[model samples]
Target: MNALARRNPWLVVACGAFIVTLAMGVRQSFGLFMRPIGLDIGIGRDMFGLAIAFQNLLFGLVQPFIGALADKHGAGRITAVGALVYAAGLLTAASATSAFGLHLSFGVLIGLAMSATTFVTVLGAVGRVVPAEKRTLAFGLTTAGGSLGQFLVVPAAQGLLSELGWRSALIVMAGVVSLVFVLAAGIAGKPPEAEEEGPPQSLSAALAEASRHRGYWLLNAGFFVCGFHIAFIATHFPAYLTDKGLDAKVGAMSLALVGLFNIFGSYLFGAWGDRWRKNYLLSGIYTARALLIVVFVSLPLGNVTALAFAAGIGFLWLGTVPLTSGLVTGMFGVRYLSMLYGIVFLSHQVGSFFGAWAAGYAYDLTGNYDFAWGASIALGLLAGLVHLPIRDEGLVARPAA
Candidate 1:
């Protein structure tokens, strides 16, 4: 498998993309269930929000360890296990009867599953296989798979919700998630031992080196804001739309449009990263997000404005994955990318926890998402400024770990 991947690395890229599509597609669709599950399960939005918050929190918290396992072992083995666990989490979520049950199944179980299956492990796998020159584009392509899933699966999930109800829709989604195990065959090799120059750096050394790097933490801060923006919108946007008297379908389609437009955004930004300064690109993306939100909120509520905002935001979505992951690879080399990027992703998810939970908290307290939107705009601007000082230097520019 390793020999085959080395011979034609695009196969690995393709397989990695498909696995992400399944894992992330199903994960993204969980937002559609917020209203229905809240109604049927007799829980308030805060309870449901808390469960999803835990999901994001746990997802980020365990990522470094999971990425380390994939770095030491192989992404295929980890991904296969994640697929099974993901199926179990979804199935369990279907049968959940209370807040604790939802927390355990949807939050804890799926969170761990995502840590195993999503971008860290998958991008790490692709990073090892693809050469440095093409790496960002590959990462972009792979990341876009998740957007593709969002574009495709969200509407399907809504359809299932309408026709079969949330429980059965979750069950069907579980079946779809199980396919990732089969697709895991594509990313079947460990990081190549011969790739790095000079003496090999241990994982501990890599972590220590990254800890001391100023730019690394800056990347983490930027990603945290990114997570905050994403989780807040994905988890709560539908309900927010419904609150404005838009049909539920509008929300689902809005999310789907974000996915669809992001397909282009992810790819183009990735290609741009290979040529332009990534830090500038990142700053622009974050600043754009803040502006978009301001315009979105200022405009009167309607289907057209809602979908326009979705398209605008979606195009910029997930573009960060490739650029950020590429930066880690450039700075540290791909030998420990799974672990290093996983650590950064952990920060992102930490922000995700606050984003998901705080929105609910703000809503339950104030009766509107005004506070959340304001926070997102502020954080976005902060992220834009944070990226400016990052010295985008490569491994050769720094001392050996």
Candidate 2:
């Protein structure tokens, strides 16, 4: 083991966790700003949703390339550039009055920035440092860090928006994201020594190999549903609550509840992924999500029901992340984890584009989110069925020791 891994494993996990927290925290807060930003700029909800959709699209598109770069070079430079770009995007977004500016700031810039800083990059680093036996738990902890960020930052952003103006809130968030530089710096140590065996595989070859695996495709397809469900709820739930004649704070609290409850949900699922059959567990999660969404949509809109639904759904929310990544590492070796996982994540963002944009589009055309809710249910069931056939064992190589 290298000095950093040997000397301070917990410290490494903490630093990695912090990086994920900052990256995901600010992104999650974007939902809170949708109404204020849209109303202030005279932009339609579709316009804001389109920009966020583009952000998700580009974030997914660039992730594979960024992950490849991190695998080849190091995460430090990529993370530093990502932090700078993310901050600049938020700053520009704060000043924007046009739809084009929103697309540029929130869509392209923030999307690419998040591609560099989020789970693929951070978790790749964690995969390298932590032992194989502990890897799933380590990923679980990192994911929980992101959930904690939502738990804290969403409520904090709400307070800031109430006290300071939305523009000021954006500026404050940009400042908060700057702290990621420090966390990235701590990850700048040498690559794992075991990685020095031979020339790294080209991105094309790595992708080709992953494509040949049935499990990889199944995982990619299943993850699309996860993204669709998360983006739809995250972007639209607040508005949904308000449309039902509840206070805006109720929407915010519902989101916070999702984030808070997910902290435990992700960890529990992740631990189960390590000890049990990951594919079956994933199938169960998707099936359960289908049932949960059915129940949630059926219930009359109210504060109590909404909050309970949020907490219940939130527990299953990002729980897919760690298991999905863990399955990737299990099927393919962690040698090309970043690149392979990035490709899978690309599917996720594609689903996100449709989820975020479609919810807004459906609401605009029909004045009800019923269509989007129905779509989520259908996709959840499809995902559950698709994952059931996945072969979770290692492809050709023996399981990692």
Candidate 3:
């Protein structure tokens, strides 16, 4: 067990991959259950959407404090507690018979649990333990884990929703999440250090410095677009496909395809960030995303078209994760990586809250996702443009006296 803490990058990546597979996979799969749960509970889709929206907001809001705790303490124990809470939330969500119950279980509890177990904490640990250059690849691989989760879990969830009831599936998920507790211990290591490239800076100092950076604020702006894109699509795409008269299987496969393709995109993009100017590469990706969305909406709709769309979108999906994370560590030291990333993620969640809620609200209002998709396309272009002109160099610290 002690040997595991000896800076094993592969092990860290693997553990992060699996833990996110469970956490984000479960979160992505929530869309599959949305229709079934709504049908059973006699609630509107907006109710579930609002619950998920709350889940997104809460997940991001709590991450900074959790990251701070992991920075000060170790991620191992926080992850364990998070896994337990996640499992309990899944169980409680299963038993919920009211909207308020869903809000408490899925919205709040799982939100807090993910704050502990997901990217900000897990990847932060990986970034600290690995070399600086390796962080892009590590963050990429870890981000890919979320995509892989989306790919594999979506189908598994579709199968489960088809065979067992949603309630039974939730109960089964509770048991599966418990395994994260074990992985948590594997990732636990010494607290983060701020002196990777310079002498240590105080936490408050790090905060003040980051707060004053224009590039940092630009990064936040681009990340908000990313959050909006993912939240809207992940929470609503499956339902959107089915509403278009496509088979339910098509919806599941659409999500799965994104996951599989995103795995490659993430790894490739991560590798590229190491060699290229990350801001430039990020610009291209966002531009590509906009183009893809435009093409997707312009075409004649069908299973093949939907799948092709999914593949294109998936290739661009989560590719931003590694680049964004790596960019943060590149500019700032690793000491406060978790908390810093958490602040960025909070902006993302704010976008997510709107994305998830707006999709449902649009559907409730006019019975379609047109407005949401159009907004996403425009935002992609804006994000791409904003990423340009970012000064990606790290802060220059004074030479030690």
Give the candidate number with the greatest lDDT: 1
Backbone clashes in candidate 1 total 0
Show how many residue pairs clash in every candidate, following the order shown: 0, 0, 0
Worst ten in a row by lDDT for model 1: 392-401
lDDT of 1 by residue, 138-234 (tens): 9999999999999999999999999999999999999999999999988986666775534678777888888888899899999999999999999
Residue pairs clashing in model 2 are none
Minimum summed lDDT over a 10-residue window in model 2 is located at 193-202
Candidate 1 residue 238 Cα shift, in angstroms, is 0.6
lDDT (CA) for every model shown?
0.91, 0.85, 0.86
Q: Tell me which of candidates 1 and 2 scores higher on TM-score.
A: 1
Model 3's TM-score against the true structure: 0.96
- What is the TM-score (0 to 1) of candidate 1? 0.98
**TM-score of predicted structure 2:** 0.96
Per-residue accuracy of model 2 over 1-401 as CA lDDT, tens digit each? 24766577666677778888888888888888888888888987788888989999999999899888877666767887899999999999989998899999999999999998889888887777777888888888889888888888899989999899899999999999998887887665546646532344555766777878988998999988888888888888888888789998998898889889999998998888889877888898899999998998787878899999989998998889889999888877677788889999999999999999989988889899889899999999999999887875654554444
Q: RMSD, each candidate, Å?
A: 1.7, 1.7, 2.0
